[model samples]
Target: MIRTRFAPSPNGLLHLGHAYAAIVAHDLARQHGGEFLLRIEDIDAARSRTELAEAMIEDLRWLGLHWDGPVVWQSTRLGSYGAAADRLRAMGLLYPCRCTRADIAAAATDHGPDGLIYPGTCRGRDVDPAGAAWRLDMARAVEIAGPLVWEDELAGPQHATPEIFGDIVLLRKEAPASYHLAATLDDAADGITLVTRGADLFAASHVHRLLQALLDLPVPRWHHHGLIVEGDGRKLAKRRGSPSLADMRRDGADGRALADALRHALLPAGLSLTTGIGWTT
Candidate 1:
């Protein structure tokens, strides 16, 4: 059976862009007679708000998107991520890194899809793994995994080139696991057969593919749908002060109508949906 998930961080209110993505994932599963799951990516305990997560559930339900089973919370699964990191550490694919963001920014010479590519400042350093951030030795990891390729529902076959991300942190100094590690493990654990999200995250899939190989997890196809953007072409984001669905609900906007419009690609006035990997809107 096909399984797709909509995992959203509970750091802010859900916006129209989030609504579009959720609707797509939910509809795809329903169309195929598959299971649609919801996950609360609340690993960032410092910024993760329980209230916000609760509100997101309300909003998703309001949007008429029904998910299967109980919600999975990342915060409750720290031990799994830690054990995966430990396995990588035992394989010598992970190294302790004491470099801060400032340290990386100061030494970075090139930028990749995910911001500055991390320079191996502490790759072979005599730093203690405990209490220090752990980074994957991408070069060595690729060597172990050998050549790899992943499939996308829309983009077709993609050659995995994780070196573009350089050495990525698997475990952060302040968090149990980074997004790459956590999401990869979570998807496999939940038996997600199809990964769906916005095109902005299409690049991150490269790093995820590597993680899946290194961790010996099941590979799932991806569908990176286009983003919902404003007239200025900027993707709707909470950080950018995008109008949230909660605000729209408070203003009495019809949730069912909104879902229908998004389903048909008939976005609200001044909002547009960009096409996915191999398709046009």
Candidate 2:
């Protein structure tokens, strides 16, 4: 059975972009007689708000998207992520990095698709593991995993080249697991067969595919849909004060109608959908 999930962080309210993504995932599952799951990515305890999560759930329900079974919270899966990290460390594919963002920017000579690539400053450093963030040795990992390819529903087949992101952090100092580690593990744990989200994360999928191989997790096909942007051509984001679904609900907007409009590409005033990998609106 195909299983798709809409994992949302509870750091802020759900906006139109989130609603559209959730609807796409939900509709895909329902149309194919598959299971639609919901996951609360609340690993960032410092910024994660319980109230926001509750509101998000309410908003999803109000938008007529019902998920199967109870919601899975990432905060409760720290041990699993830690064990996976330990396994990678044991394989000599993981290293402790004490370099901060400032350190990397100062030493970085080249930039990849995912910002400045780390100059491997702490690759061979004998830093204490407990006080430093853990980074995956991308070159070593790819070598061990051998050649890999992942399928995308829209983009078709894709070659996995995780080195584009350089050494990715599996575990951050502030969070138990980084997005790459946590999401990859959770998808496998939940038996997800299809991963669907915005196209903005298409590049990140390369990193996730590498993690799946390193952890020996099940590989699932991906579908990176387009992003919803405002009239200014900027993608709708909570941090940018984009109008939220909750606010729309409070203002008596018809949730079902709005969802239908989004499905048919008939967006509201000042909002448009940009398809493909790069969202240049």
Q: Please, what is the TM-score per model?
A: 0.97, 0.97
The list of candidate 2 runs beyond 4 A from truth reads 278-281
Q: What is the C-alpha lDDT of each candidate?
A: 0.91, 0.91
lDDT of 1 by residue, 220-248 (tens): 99999999888998899899898899888
TM-score of 1: 0.97
Candidate 2 vs. true structure, TM-score? 0.97
